[model samples]
Target: MSDGPTDLPAPREAPDAGPYWQAAREDRLVMQNCYGCGTYRFFPSLLCPECGSEEQVWGPCSGRGTIYSLTTVHRAPSPAFRKIVPYTVALIELEEGPRMMTNIVGEGRNEAAIGDAVEVCFEARGTDAKVPQFKLAGA
Candidate 1:
């Protein structure tokens, strides 16, 4: 078993995510908040989904969340992920009010449970892109 997050695919940052990527590279998670509708969004969009408003600002995320649901992949649909099969991919509910799809690292596959407290950690693949991953939080 791996002791840390591994075998992650290279992150492909969105065209408008230069600042967001910069934060992640510094080991911080950043998400966009739409000022118009007061909703948080991931993957960085130009328009707010709740109210179709374009007014938005980027800020640092809390990086604390709970595992909402998870699935273990026994087979990789792509060759790039084949080596890392049987890993847990989860949808975590953030404490700051967003749900993100990310990999649950560190603990065993069965160690992850519904509502497990997790904290965000950054994984850098290169000089430009950094990915956000989750791990079991401390007491």
Candidate 2:
């Protein structure tokens, strides 16, 4: 994870998402899988939406996905993001079937399009957290 600016707000860790954040801090991507129904989920829920099962497992992800949608931010929403105004934010559809919103970074980020393949990368947030970001596959 690169040392990002400290002006931006850091994400508050959710009680159910400690493992996920821990994995991110370790530079790994993981998803919650329902052991009862074999369904994968994101955003860390306590119960499985598919079967109402409380049993779930944290599993490593392939860290690969396709760009389901995207937009270029030509203006920063806040002063903290002013330095990176022309950045790309995309909804990535993971191979595990969950869609996660993240930034498209690295070379060719500005040219991202729907259906483009992407791979996960970690970026530093404040001092203690790492945010999962994406870049064009093999770029």
Judging by TM-score against the true structure, name the best candidate: 2
C-alpha lDDT (0 to 100) for residue 23 of candidate 2: 96
Q: Write the per-residue lDDT of candidate 1 for residues 20-60, one digit (tens) a residue.
A: 77888889888888999788887678898889999888877
Supply the TM-score for candidate 1.
0.86
What are the per-model C-alpha RMSD values against the true structure? Answer: 2.2, 2.1
Candidate 2 residue-wise lDDT, 50-138, digit = tens? 89999999999999999999998888888877766777889999999999999898888878899999999988788899888999999
lDDT of 1: 0.80
List residue ranges in candidate 1 displaced over 4 A: 1-7, 126-128
- Ten contiguous residues minimizing lDDT sum, candidate 2: 1-10
The TM-score of predicted model 2 comes to 0.92
Task: Determine the C-alpha RMSD for candidate 1 after optimal superposition of all C-alphas.
Answer: 2.2
